[model samples]
Target: MPVREFSSSVPLWAKRIASAIYVERRRAGLTQAALASRAGVRQATVSQAENDPRSMRLDTLEKILASLDLTLASARRPH
Candidate 1:
C-alpha cells in the first residue's frame, strides 16, 4: 500500500511518531509481533504505540524505530 501523508491538523508529536512507525512497519512488511520481538518489547506495546503513541515512552519509541532502521528527527516548523 502507498504511504499516506499525515495532515497538518495532526500536530501532536505522539500521533506523528505513531503514524511514522506504522507506515515504516508496513513498508518493511513486518507484523506487529515481529516488530515487537525485534525491538525487544511486548507485542501489546507495539499495538499500543501504533494505536496510542501518547502512552509510549521515549526510550521504547527509540528502540522500535531502531529496529526498523529508522531514527527520530526534528526540525523547526515554518513560522
Candidate 2:
C-alpha cells in the first residue's frame, strides 16, 4: 500500500469540521464503527475525520453526513 502524507498540525477549518462530526456523531448515538458501516466507509476513516478532517474528501464527508441525516447546506449554516 502507498503511504499518505498528512499535515503535522490540523488547520482551523479542519478543526471545525472535526468538531462538528464528533458532536453530530454523539448526538446521533452512533459509534464510529456503526457510523462507518452506515456511511459505507471504514471505521478508521471515520476516526481520522473526527480527529483531523483536512484530508477528508467531499464525497466521503457527504456520505457521512447523509448517513447521519445531515446535509452540507445545513452544516454550513451557523447554528
Q: Indicate which candidate wins on lDDT.
A: 2
Instruction: Give me the runs in candidate 2 sitting further than 4 Å from their true place.
Output: 1-8, 76-79
Model number with the top TM-score? 2
| Sliding window of 10 residues with minimal summed lDDT for model 2 | 1-10
Q: For residues 1-79, what per-residue lDDT tens digits would candidate 1 score against the true structure?
A: 5544544555566566777778778889999999999999999998877666665688998898888777766211110
Model 2 has how many clashing residue pairs?
Answer: 0
How accurate locally is residue 7 in candidate 1, as Cα lDDT from 0 to 100? 46
Clash count for candidate 1 is 0
Each model's lDDT comes to: 0.74, 0.76
Instruction: Give the poorly placed runs of model 1, Cα more than 4 Å off.
Output: 2-11, 74-79
